[model samples]
Target: MTPPPPAEPVAAMVRPASRYRDSKVNRDLLGVMKGTSIGYWALLGLCVLMVHVAGGIWVYQVYKGLGIAGYAHPVFWGAYIVTFVFWVGIAHAGTLISAILFLFRAKWRNSINRSAEAMTVFAVLTAAQFLGIHVGRMWKSYFILPYPNQRGLWINFKSPLMWDTFAISTYATISIVFLFIGLIPDLAIARDRARGFRKGLYAALSLGWQGTTNQWKAHNRTVLHLSGLATPLVLSVHSVVSWDFAVAIVPGWHSTIFAPYFVAGAIFSGFAMVLTVMIPVRRIFRLEAYITDYHFENMSRFILLTSIIVGYAYLAEFWTAWYSGVEAEQSAFWLRAFGPYWISSWVMIIFNGVLPHILWFKKVRTHVPTLFVLSVCINIGMWFERYVIIISGLSREYVPAVWGTFTISWAELGIVGGSFAFFSMFFLIFLKLFPIIAIAEVKEIAIHERAHAEEGAH
Candidate 1:
């Protein structure tokens, strides 16, 4: 009789969905949406101030002319071009990790994909700024676009710049769409929890998403289609970027291997950037449970793999230069290692090629502090890599008389600093506004784990 009485409540017999919904992971992540701290505001203000400094420098340069920013005879493509290529390369890691890994069903990516995708979008935006700065006449920059004009001048279809324009624009558009599609379900969650204008905004962004089985099925199909489309862009955008240099007949630039070389370098720096951004984010947001040591180790392994590829590309370049018996090519390669910009070239080799091997040690990979420092060094090395490629190639051309050296002026330095500030500003704002981690995906994982636990109990 007592046993029968205790069997009373069906609610107690079956677990309520809320039990799974209010998981520790869900609660912890949702807490980030609550409000920001003083540190966030302080960092945001510092970023804004840095951006203003950059804007002031740009204003001064525009008024004072391009002379103020260190443009010269042979080295016209100085820091701006290097920074552009570096940022473009940085953009690759995001799409590769988010879209390609998604298509492969790499479950580990679920923790960091949102942040990586956001980084992709912002990096592209930052990279676009360099094009305007490099144009000198920023006002007439729109001329690069393919449109019917009164002057009857059209963009050259055969030009690599035209290809770059198309590739970057298309990649940015698809990336934005892919990022938004993934955000919809999470937006719905935010919409439900928020109040006032914030709620309405998220509601609009979420597009009336009600979590039904059919809706989820459609969502899954859409994601698969987008992922399939984005995967090639991950490869093509950076490869096309490499072609900007590769198509050139310059001794250092023209090589059949440049495409893969640039692609590998892009991935190398991109993962470094992800580590730079995510390490701090995971700590600040207390996302340790979600973005665990395991995630960091996985990324470290990726960094190690890309490092090896890049190292091979470097050796291959040297081998090609020496084996071809082309005096100019050999000279360019040797000059890169031991010429005027020798310091920068060796720095690139040591930081990008050699330093990352430290990640092979499990302790370095697992320790956040060590990984962060290594990641920063890798990014620095990557920038130097671009510098060596652009400056070294043009600095000592076949005709040494026409060759010249370039130094980055204060204005250009400000712009480079500003680009970093801008990227950080946007990413920080994104962290505060959106669920930085994917809540719905975390819930799905929790549900899967719980189901497995029940099966084991049986």
Candidate 2:
């Protein structure tokens, strides 16, 4: 048997130790090797100011009513629903990057896995806040749960809201667990370097991590298990979120394609949000070496591929409407393309599904400024896509008498603003407290790639 193909090469199984593990505190924080910049401080202050203004607006909404949000007769969902869906779409990227990429063994994901995972946690919090504010009777929102209430009614599992509660809760819990598990080894690193209260906090979080063989084995097993659990959740949570619209009988809302369509859109937009947040952060933290052009290019390639998928979904929806010859569906499709909400529809097409194609060029994808600009546009386009789907679709129905325009009042806009502010604040705090990049994973990948190269050379 030709000596069993030369014993399959020892280098194929394990890599040599790395210099990264030997580096000191300032030396090892590759992502934040450079100190925080002036821009970061500016962004934080701006975020705080915006949040204060937004909080004031929310208070105004409480004083008034849901009607203050432009929810006239038939347009009950308006901008809050649009923002809700938009934030949910934004939340998809973290799981996709961390769980999906980890499963696929995507090497380029090394640079982004930690920040992207954090984004998932923060985005979920942001989306949850919007839901809390959107539900006018916030305290009574508990009625949607299965707890014994004054009405003596259990949860309506049949309701999309209950499904959403389940999906979002599962998503948030899984994401947090995955994030903390990934942080343990890094926390131990911090614990070694820190003093006083920081040391205590890091030590407690680290759970006595000593980088032993068993600890590393257990850590890897835990990560593998969490990734397995989160993979299905990435699909199920978004599908359940889509059910909020798909299960409804409204003309535009009742579509068989909503589940997959919403999922595709979520991923497309979520990737955009990840890029939007990460680009500035990488720059602020001077993480150019860690988050390289290669990673950005890979991310852009994903964006381009997903943009095509979203475009295909868009075409399929219209084709089905025309093929079925359903007047309500046909009219809903037409209204999206040519009616009052057509602007948002067109913007969604041009920005989310179209503009990302520019990334197919190496120059565009690798260039920081271009990618940053495109990401911002894609994010805006995605928000408008949600607005078009929720508000425009709900604004009109079979009866013209109930047809009305959906407009966003300042209060509703403020809540959306506050959501961003809250998410940013949480993420900023997390960055200071934890390693913004998965140092252990990155080092592992780096070693693996090096070993693979040496083996190939042999």
Candidate 3:
């Protein structure tokens, strides 16, 4: 009897039928939904502190009026406009990744597009903030909008600034919608993994996704359509932003090359910013398996491509000025290259045009430390490029009699630092709340691989 009793039942391994044949994807991505890293908390706290300090500085500037911004006569658009353009350029990489690369069926984008799209939204919001700050009266900022109000004002549809308002808003709306659509299934996965308050939030955001065949079909179709719609915006939005300068009667600002030149520069800097942010994210989050050296190499190739184009643009600017026989254009550019802002011009040329050549070497492109340093250098140079473009042109202009030097005020500098921190803060929160990698897309790659293997066996 004791021997019979000892023959207890062996536990059966009853895995669920609907479960993914490979569950590692879910385990790896969903693991991030729980637990906060100490490093993450430290970084988040630092960003929040920086943001608060920036906010206080902005308040002081607001209270004191535009005088505190260190704006001289003709140099009205100084750091504020430079910072604005820098962020607008920052926003371009996302649209390029999510929309253009998707059209080309670039699978490398799958690992990075989620974060790229989020970056675009945050950058747009940051850039919009400067418009108000630049206006000097945050209260009357609504005047920038095109709406007809009770105060007998007509919308100037012809204004290039208005064009900026339309382009950026539309770009933001589409980007948010595109990001949300992509997030649905990923949120559902997070919802199932999360508990308590986060569970409820994800469940609502995921909209009851059950991974039905019809739901997937709809998602694929919708993504394709939206990708097509977003494709043109990549070029148009930045072209309109360039018009803000090109349409101006400013000497160096008015050039036919401005549109393509600005677009190339935008993507050049945007890709650099992406690399800068993602390299840190990849290291911190342990996403090397997803965001491998392969992805980084491909991104570096783009940096090289855009950099060559940008360098050509630099030479072309001087060429056009010399060839066109326009004294104003020649003078503005001369001042840019050889005048007081020569430091920024050389920094822009050397950092953006010269340094990117290192990416031509496979070893440098694939090397993490070198790539990261190059990215940071590219960012600094891009900032300096805008500085030279705006301040250099505005510094000497056609009338040297009205010329004045624009110093980078502490308030302006603080706000720029804060903008970076602000973007980092939201991105940090996003890492915890959502699946940083697109789980569904990655698993689809696995499923296809398995199916091909099985078919080959058969």
Best by lDDT: 1
- Full ranking by TM-score: 1, 3, 2
Instruction: Report each candidate's C-alpha RMSD, comma-separated, in the order given.
Output: 3.3, 6.4, 4.8
TM-score of each: 0.95, 0.91, 0.94
TM-score of 3: 0.94
Q: Better model by lDDT, 1 or 3? A: 1
Candidate 3 overall lDDT versus native: 0.88
Number of backbone-clashing residue pairs for each candidate, in the order shown: 0, 0, 0
- Model 1, C-alpha of 9: deviation from truth (Å): 18
Per-residue lDDT for 384 in model 1? Answer: 95
- Report every candidate's CA lDDT: 0.90, 0.82, 0.88
Question: Per-residue alpha-carbon lDDT of model 1 for 57-146, expressed as tens digits?
Answer: 988888887888888888888899999999999999889888789888999999988889899999999998899888688899998898
Off by over 4 Å in 3: 1-22
User: How high is the lDDT of residue 149 in model 1?
Assistant: 100
| 114 Cα displacement, candidate 2 (Å) | 0.4
